[model samples]
Target: MTTAIRRRGPDADGAWVDTDRGVALGHRRLSIIDLSPGGAQPMESADGRYVIVYNGEIYNFADLRADLEAAGQAPGWRGHSDTEVLLAALSAWGLDRTLAALNGMFAFALWDRAEGRLSLARDRMGEKPLYHGWVGQGEQRTLLFASDLAALHAHPAFRPEIDPASVSQLLRFGHVPDPASVYRGVGKLAPGTRLTLSADGGEDAFVYWDTLSEYARAAGEARFRGDAIEAVDELERLLGNAVLRQSVADVPLGSFLSGGIDSSAVTALLQHNASGPVKSFSIGFSESAYDESPHARAVAAHLGTDHQELIVTPEDALAVIPDLPGIYSEPFADSSQIPTYLVARMAREQVTVALSGDAGDELFAGYNRHVHAHRSWPRLARIPRPLRRLAGRAMTAVSPARWDAAIGPLVARKAVGVGEKMHKAAGVIASRDGDALYATLISVNPDFRELLRHPSEKDGFEGRALEIVAGLPLPDRMMAMDAIHYLPGDILTKVDRAAMAVSLETRVPMLDVDVIRFAWSLPADMKLRDGVSKWPLREMLYRHVPRQLIERPKQGFGVPIHDWLRGPLREWAEGLLFDSAASLDEYFDRPAIAALWQRHLSGAGNHQHRLWPILMFQAWRARS
Candidate 1:
């Protein structure tokens, strides 16, 4: 895993093992601080009872160390890497209390020799990635884990089995939710939570902290602008300090400049603070809708940075599809992984460490889903349940306007119109009496039952869905939903696997705990206002760059998969869908899968949703 992540920092590599306890930890160092050998891992505590394998930079290690010193528990001195500081803190204060004091993006595994326990934790927003799985038993009882799925795949015990519910969720959204992996036995650690496994065969897992509600009530909009400006200023300070800290490596370091607000902000700040032009890289596409090369070029030129670009073709993306199972060690369906992987490769060609502008959207309510949900609640409340059914029926009866007729009419009616989807979405939350808000945020596959091969399959994930959703309070449910469901299951997982497959390390600055706390504390209006999403983030971006540069409609960073499967990828799609005439009963209903493909190919219904999963499943099953 460290070797795969070496592009993020090629300067050093080390592994720590406790063979006596049958455990091993590896570190792929991207030396951002304390470049000497003193910063190595698995860093040991003073008494040597605790050891850690950590990924990511901690921006506040200095202050943390000071606090420990003030308490008179001076740690054994070592190199300047945050690794040593984090280990010391874990040792002195213990896991639960120490985690409360951290302010960074991290995923770490700490082994306590004295207690004969293993603890795994991810930063609050899951800015970093961690994957784990159990193998055989009895002494060799294999339980392996890593920062990326590819490393776990290297182990002999790894077995790949498709999780049906994960497939359904992927089709509805773009990524799998936490605690569920594409491979049946492998799972991701939930963000803001910890898991401990012990030699006594006992296991414990629970949430350590969550800031959504606290941030929601922190301050009102009347004070938000001033607070926001201060927040941005502070963010600038944190980011600058983080980059400088991360830049302290023994190897070459670089940054990714997508020319989007986040990347541009990072690149600009890095250049402003650095003594020389920073090395940056970007990925472009031939397809116009997916192309951000022009904007990337503009940003690179403005920053006067050393930049390189790679314009990839559809074939370039398709070629990597086969490698998905190996890299993800699970069944992941996020299409943007293609671009993420390519960009990582481009940056790896020139430098080791690179910075990314991830998490801005989540922190600042940048997603249209959040705004749409906020706006649509009022309208949904006005419609009575009986009327909703009648209206749905009326809409369904209307003929297609020059399009295919059968399911199109049903789609036209049941579908929330682009303008009304958000409002109608409020129906999920408007009741104000239940967990409908969370249900609204996560109902993309409400009709999942329609696609299941058997009615019995619905029972599989129902308990999981209720348990996770029920555990969170109203104020935190949405963000918590994202943190647990979307962030690692999809976003972080997508970036980690894609980048690591190419030996790249992508760091998320906005996901820093401090920024997350600020995001949580801002008033709802600051997050969503005037029907505009991510209002505060918009305010922040306008400070350093012109709004005209990025004030256009949001275009998702995705491939033309829907079109391609209907076009160039049709043959491949069909072969997978129809070829398994003999042995299809164990996985999917072959007839149902074939019918969906036929419907899509015939344009009877846009069955892309139904087809994508089947195609991806077949491809993944073959490889696994």
Candidate 2:
């Protein structure tokens, strides 16, 4: 099982078994911190009460070690890996206290020999993954857990059955939300949670840290009494500290610079604090509309960092298609996974650790939906429901191309996405409330429930963990929803799988617990004001790079998937959707998919987003 996940840790492999207790633990080491046998796993405590196999890094391990020493609980450490510090902390402070004090990304399995208990935990932001479930029935049942599903598949007792509800969810959200995996009986441990199981089959799960609770606490406290300028300055300090802590790696480290506010801010702070130039990596595309390499280059040159870039062709992305199922180990349909994988592969050539600017958007209200909810929703709401629906129908009456042509002469070429945005906004305007509006904005298939063979038990928006913040302001509620759902489920999942596929460790500084709490405490106006989303974040970023260079519209870190599906990828897509129609009939309504494909080929409208998920699922089905 450990050998199956060697790509996640190629440096070393080890196994420890306790036949007397019917327990075994295995590990694959990437050797990021302490580069000696002292850092090896499955590591045991000096007292031999605890054994743990851990993945991911602890940026504040040094601080935690100092605290342990100050508290007079420090074990005379043999080596300086975070794992040793963690094990010591666990032995001293207990699981809950150790997890609460952590400021890093990690997923670990800790076994307590003294008590015959097993504990599993994931990082607060879902940066690392932990999958656990029982296999077999009644007396034959055996519990299985691993960082990757392939490892679980390696166990003879493991049997994976596809869950139709989760497949429908994949078609809806582009990724399966946590607490539910694509396979039945297996489940992802939610972030900020710890699950403990005893030898007699007693199990309990507790949330050690939760973003929803933090959001509520921040909102209730109403802290950050300072004005906007003070907020920005404090934010800068918090982010700077986060970057510095995450920069603690014995191996070469860098940042993924997209020239956007988020990555640019992280890159600038990294260079500002590093003794020398920090290695920054980005990828370019021949599709001018989709490429951000020039902007990243400008930022890199301005920052004077060691910059490297690759101009990727369509073939480069196409080459990665066949590898997606294995790379993700499930049916994930996020098209940007191509560029994310490419950039990670590029960085792996130069560095082992890379920091990203992922959760800033979710934490700081940087998504377009946040801005639209703030600016457009009130006006749209003022119109009666019937009128709003009429307006939405009217907007969709014209094709996206015609709408683009009508507005093309007035805006810059990069703003051509405006028409598609308008099309999406029209659909959202018909929503009855903020929840419905947010749901419409994020949905890839609004009517997926109807398209599936069996009725879906839950819609994308149902059973989410974000209901805690439902009574907050529309923008805050939406941001909270995104932080709990989209940030972890889609963004973090995409980066983790893509980067790990290349044996690279990617960290997100913006998601530091302190940073997240601070971001939520600020007044809503500080996050989005006067039609500018992420205003405070932009203010902080401006202190590093010129506003003009970074002030452009937000572009997704993406490939030209729409163009690819219609052009070079047409035959491949057709083979999956049409030639293999018989295979998909078990899940999809064939006539509906065929009609959508035909409409897309005719250029009547862009159905690529709708079609891509089907292709990904079909491709994954073929492999699974």
Candidate 3:
């Protein structure tokens, strides 16, 4: 089981078990903060009453260590590793106090000898992955947990059923949401929550922290009493502190610089806080429309950091396509996964840990939908419902190919996927409510149920975003929903899996607790003004790098999967899509799948968003 996820921790491996008590634990070490043998696990507390196997860094371990000593409750040190610090702190402070004091990404399990109990916990922001569940029935039932699903599958008794609901959700969102894994009887532990299981077959789950309640309690009650410039200054201070804490690593470190407001701001801060020059990594494309490397290079030159970039070829990206299912260890269809893995592989050559600018959009209202909601929602709402639906249908009725043929001169091909964009806009224009509107904005296929063999009564997540930010402005509500849903299920999951596949660690200082809370407290005007977005972030980047070097129309971290499927990848895609012998054939409607493929091929529409998920699932299911 430990060997199955060796890429997650190649430095070392260890296991501890008490057969007499029917308890066992395993760990694969990715030595970052501490490299000594004393830092090895599965480690036991000094009193020999507790044992733990943990993944991820505790950025505040040193602070907690100091507090322990200050109170004269510190245990004799085993090693400098945060793993040891965690065990010691948990022993001294007990569970609740220790969990509350923690400030970093982590997923871990602690075994209590005296009580014969096992406690599982994940970080507040869902950075690290932890899964736990029972596999068998009655007396033979077995409980399993791991950072990757591949590890649990290594167990002989672990037989899981396909979850149809999970498949429907994946088709809509591109990645499976929290509390549901691809398989039945297994779950991705919710971030900031814990589960305690005992030999008596008794178990309990608790939420130690929640983003919604926390945002409400802090941002609602103590809103930042500052103007836009003042908010920017406060943001700078908070992010500066976060970078300082996250920079404390024993291994070589760097940052991902896309030259956008998010990455540039993070890279700028990383260089400012570092003792010497910082390393920066980026991925490039031959296609200028999809390229951000030049911007990254300009920013790196300005920051004076050791910069590296990889100009990836179609062949380079093609070589990685076969490994996507294994790298993700599940069915995931974020086209950007291609370039993200390429960058991580390149960065791993020089740095063990790389800081990212992810979550900036969620925290500070940087997405296009946030802008649309603020600027267009009122106008959209003024139209009668039936007329809006009629207009939307009229837009989609004209196939993308026809739209491009008719208006291609107006909207250039450089904007690639222009017709697809129009189709998506049609969906947004026709939404019935704010919740449905945001759902349509984020989803790949708003009508996903039509393709399912057994459609769900409804996908619970569509309305979930509205519930999270019930009374906030549309822009604030949209961003807040993404901070909870999209940020974790897709963006963070993609980065974590892609980086860990190469034994590299990635951190997000923008997701730092202080930064998140502060962003939420600021008024919507500070995050979005007039029609512009991420106002404070732009100001911060300008202070370190020139405005021209940083400012540009936003571009996604994406690959040309739509083009590939019609070109070099077409043969491979066909084998999976039409391979009647495949497992996905049993779940997805064949006629529907074939029609979508034909439409994409004929340029009637850009169906990559819808097809990619099905292809991913088929590829993953083949091996599973």
Candidate 4:
């Protein structure tokens, strides 16, 4: 694993193994802070109570170091590496308190010699990736972990198998939900949680922190902003400090310039703080509609950074898709991961750590669905049940099967689902409003009402998220659901697996726990006001970059999957849906799948929704 990272950033690599204590920690040095060997890891504390292997930048390490010194515990400074400061901080303050003080992106493993235990933790928003697995049985069992799943595959104990429910969910949501990975044996450490393992490999996982619920209960008036001026000013202050802190690397560091508000904001701030040109990288697609390189180039020129860009074709993306199972160590179907991986690979060639603008979307309610669902709520209520049903049937028939294959269907299935949501909301909200609305918005699978009949199915999957928001007021629940669901499951998972696949460490400044708590305390209207999503976040961006550059409609980072399935990927997709050599009977109804495929091939409907998950499952099966 260290070797792979070395290839990505070759400045240094350090490793230490305690055979007596049954622990091993390895680090690939990027030398972002205190570039000397003193920053080396596996880092041990002066008292030898704790040792740590960490991946990420700790923006507030200097401040944290001063705080530790003020507390009357000063270890002689070797170099100004936050890595050493972090290990000492743990020894001085212990894990729980130390974690609370951190304000950067990190996934670290700490071995406590005194306690005879090893603890693994990811940052609050999961900006870093951690994968763990135990192989063999009984006394011979062994636990292995790494920043990416590919490293885990190096162990002989790992196997490849698809989890049926995971396949269903990934296909529906474009990423696997947390606590469950695509792999059968391996599991991802949930964001803000920790796992402690004994020398014997017995392990216990626990949540040390969860910011959403905490913020929901915070006194709102403390950080409350009554208008855009206050919102923008506070955001600018919070984000500028976050960027400044995250920039505390001893080695060369850079930013990912997406030309979007988030990345642009980061780049602008980096330029302002740095004495020399800030390094920046951007990945583009051959499809003009998908390409944001032009925007990135403009932003890079505007910022005067040492900029680099790469234009990847669909063929380029296709080449990487098959390798995903190994890269992710589980089933993850986020198509954007293709570009994310490519970009990270490009960035790693020049810089060790790259900062990103990821959490702004989730924190500020930037998703279009949030807007669409909100708008449809009132309109959906006005239509009478009989009229909705009649309209749905008529709309479903208006576009014939042939027309669907050619022109795509104008089916009211989506509209009907939208209409029925009102009635469903009534039924669900009657029990609890936050729980129901959250459930309604997040369910991406086909009407699983019928699928629920099977005893083997994971029940109430939609309710799982709402359960996190059960007691919160509506505004907080909305933010909490995104934090728990979209942040870790989609955004973090996409960036971590993709970035680490190329051995580049990507940092998310916006996800600092303190920043997240402050954002969550704001009212929902601030997030989505006057039909605009992320209104507060936009105002925040304006404080740094001109608003006009990002004033256009939100163009999400996504692949043209709908078009790809019908274009270059047709044969591969068709084989999975119909002539699939693998036996899918254990998980899917083969005949039903064939029918869905025929429905698409014969122009009955667009089957990409049903097709994507199955294809991914089959691809994984073939690889395994």
Would you estimate the TM-scores of all the predictions?
A: 0.83, 0.98, 0.98, 0.86
Clashes of each: 8, 0, 0, 11
Report the poorest 10 consecutive residues by lDDT, candidate 3.
457-466
Worst 10 residues of 4 by lDDT: 413-422
TM-score of 4: 0.86
lDDT of each: 0.67, 0.88, 0.87, 0.70
lDDT of 1 by residue, 1-624 (tens): 556445434567888877677778887766656777888777888778898988876767888888889998767676666788888888788999888888777888999999999999988777677788887767767777777665776677766566667766655554566666666778878778889999888999967764333343443322245554676566667656665655555567788887777777777777877898889898888987688888888778877899899999999988877676667655566667778888887787787668787766666666655664567644665667676656645543442222333333555332312322433333443344334545545544444455556423422234444444453333334554565556666777778767766666667766666566666666556566677776666666666666777676665677767667888888877776667642445556666666666655654445554466556666666665
Q: What is the lDDT of residue 268 in candidate 1?
A: 74
Better candidate number, 3 or 4, judged by TM-score:
3
- Top-down lDDT ranking: 2, 3, 4, 1
Write one digit per residue (lDDT tens) for candidate 2, span 248-323.
Answer: 8889999999889999999999999988999999999988988999999999999999999999989988999988
lDDT, candidate 4, 141-211, per-residue tens: 77777776656666676665556566656655656777677777777788888888886547787777765
Q: Candidate 2: worst 10 consecutive residues by lDDT?
A: 459-468
RMSD of each: 5.1, 1.5, 1.4, 4.6
What digit string (tens of lDDT, one per residue) describes model 3 on residues 1-624?
A: 999999999999999999888778999988898788888989999878899999998988899899988999888887788888888888887887888889999999999998999999999889999988788778778789999998998988898787888889889989888978999989999988989998898998888887777766655787888787888898899998888889888899999988888988889999997778899999999878889999999999999999999998889999999899999977998989999999999999999999999988998889889888888887998899899999999998988888877777786446777777888889889888777788789888788887889876657464554665687777777777786778888999999999999999999999888898898898887788767789888888788999989767888988888889999999999999897678556889888988999999987888999999999998888877
Q: Residue 482 lDDT in model 1?
A: 62
Task: Write down the lDDT that model 4 would get.
Answer: 0.70
Please give the distance, in angstroms, between residue 466's alpha carbon in candidate 4 and its true position after superposition.
2.7
